[model samples]
Target chain A: MRSILNITDLSLEELDQLIATAEDMIADPKKYSEVCRGKKLATLFFEPSTRTRLSFEAAMLELGGSVLGFSEASSSSAAKGESVADTTRVVGCYADIIAMRHPKEGAPVVAARKAGVPVINAGDGGHNHPTQTLADLLTIWRNRHTFEGLTIGMCGDLKFGRTVHSLVGAMARYAGVKFVFISPEELKIPQYVITDELEPRNIPYKEVTTMEEVMPELDVLYMTRVQGERFFNEADYIRLRDTYILTPEKLTTAKEDLIIMHPLPRVNEISVKVDDDPRACYFQQVLNGKFMRAALIMKLLEVNV
Target chain B: MIIGQIKDGIVLDHITAGRGMDIYKILELDKLDCTVALIERAVSPKMGRKDIIKIDQAMDIDFDVLGYIDPGITVNTIRDGEVVERRQMALPERVVGVLKCKNPRCITSVEQELTQEFKLTDRKNQVYRCIYCDHKASK
Candidate 1:
């Protein structure tokens, strides 16, 4: 069965196709409403994520499919110590497709291995989050209309930012894409990302401590929050949480059409004042997430309007 | 120093000087019932210094552990005190139940029954990542 455990699972063509489908969905929502009429989506979230869980549930609902499964581990059989493999196997018997989010990395991979139906990894610890990358991709595509020759400056915690990692991995596949990593020394992008993704592809990228230095050069400024949950040391999280804040002052040198994005659930990493700016596409990213997810669900289910 | 030739077993040669003990410990050579000899810092013409291991019984060996620890090491199968076949090691694409994922956030840490697996992601760098968490394996 096909499962999206990582963003790399989808090729560049598939990404463009998904983007095209999402755009078409936006233009004609009623045309695809009943595509997944009899399908059932099981959202197996072992972690608490209101946004991602609801997004999947809403996507299934909007596609005329019913949604089942629990919101958190506590509400599921996982709390009673049932394995993800067994749970997925049981849920596969009920749901046509599965969207799983777990606190442990590779839990969805285990589920995908055991599950007979298609599996979608919503979020897997600090590891892969393919769907979030899909949302970011669609948002970037809609705004810029191209991934080529775009300089993306990713700021804040890149070390544990799974979304940033996934996006970088996805974007590196495109030609003429450059990355400017803006983060504190402690939370810089991992070496594997540099070695495995950038260096191998000969993709041009630079790491900088200050975002202001690279602000004017970026066509896309992807801001990520320094999540406290990802940090083992509370003091370290506190120190780096406010390291890079995107304010209106920071945008003075940025391009007028520069698209600013966040994965949402922001905590002071992006100021509220910047939300009114025409370039702030984070909220639109959320709405695009639903559409992209709907397109993904349809593609995985092999449903046609 | 000279070690006796095994009538039937295997000979491990050309291990990097200091990593013999690591290979020995990881392979649990001490648990073997048959006679085993570890020659560390042995004189070698090819290598400035090397380590060699001799086993007295023909038994199943975990080649993944051997390949992971020292891919350059040579393995010679012995029969009737004669070298029958020689093998050169390469990093296996995937190894299972050999190394554990140390990352606490890995699903294998909680799911004890799950097999601990690692994939050789970077051959140039000799980097193996835990298949579950993508955490780089530290040698």
Candidate 2:
């Protein structure tokens, strides 16, 4: 059974295939609508994530598949202190596939091992969120037409942003892609990502503090929220939250075709004024998220149009 | 340092000095009923000084633990007071339940029944990342 626990789990070929499938779904939604007819999807969200849960549910619904399962741990068997593995095994019998979101990192990994059916990791704490990266990739593909040679600038909380890490790792596989990490010193990209992902692969990248310094050079400016939940200290979160707010003024130096992306439910990082900017694609990223998820669901389910 | 020879047991030789205690503690050899010897800072011509652990009874040894704690330690199987077989330790590709992931958000932290597993990602640096959260195992 195929399970997507991390973005790295999908090879470049598989990623391309999923992207192609998403594009096809976009081209003719009615053709692929009932491909998963009579199938069931169990959404075992051990935490509260309305957007992700809705995205998964909508994807299944669009695929003509029925959706089952809980939204939070309090509603699920997890509240009774049942293990993820146990719940997954039980749910596998009821649903053809599972999309799980948990507050604890690698909780879906446990579920995947026990699940007889394919398990999709929606989000796992501040860890791998492969589908978000899928959405980001689709957005990039739609905007830039290729992953090669794009100077991508990632700003805000690079350290704790799993989407940034996953996206960086995914994009590193493509040829000639450059990364510009723009974040405060405290929220700088993790060292392991530099040493392990970028350095080893000879992917050229630079770390900078100011967004304006690298604004004009980027083909993609990936903005991320400084998540308050990720920070242990509320004061630290408060101090760093407003570090890199992307305003329309900031994008004056940016490329006219520059794609502004964010794994959504964003708070104030990208100003409301920037939403009117033709370059802003964060909302488009949300719609792309649904399509990519539908593609991912079909792939993991081994369904055909 | 005079230590009694084992009749039928396993001998761990050439452990990097100062890590014998770590090996002992991690292996939980102190709980063993049989005679277990941990010789520290013993003179070695090749290594300047080394640690050796000798177990007086044949038991299932975790070679992965031995390899991870200190690689290149020689394992000698003593049968009737004679070394019957000798094996050399090397870095294991994967280790389970040997190291605990320190990442608080990791699934292993909340799920006590789950095995703590790590895979060797960088061989030259000897870096093992948690299989669950990809957190680097603390040395």
Fnat of each prediction? 0.91, 0.87
Task: Residues A126-221, candidate 2: write the lDDT tens digits.
Answer: 888999999999999998889999999999999999899999989999999999999999999999899789988999999999999999899999
Model 1 lDDT per residue over A1-305, tens place: 59889999998888989999999999999888888999999999999999999999988898899999999899999989899999999999999999999999999989999989999999999899999999999999999889999999999999999999999999999999999999999999999899989999999999999988999999999999899999889999988889899999989999989999999889998999999999999999999999999999999998876
| Stretches of candidate 2 exceeding 4 Å from the true structure | B1-7, B33-35
Report lDDT per candidate.
0.93, 0.93
The residue pairs that clash in candidate 1, if any, are none
**Candidate 1: share of reference interface contacts reproduced:** 0.91
Which CAPRI quality tier does the interface of model 2 achieve?
A: high
Q: Which ten residues in a row have the lowest lDDT in candidate 2 chain B?
A: B63-72
Against the true structure, what is every candidate's RMSD? 1.4, 1.6
Residue A37 shift from truth in candidate 2, angstroms: 0.7
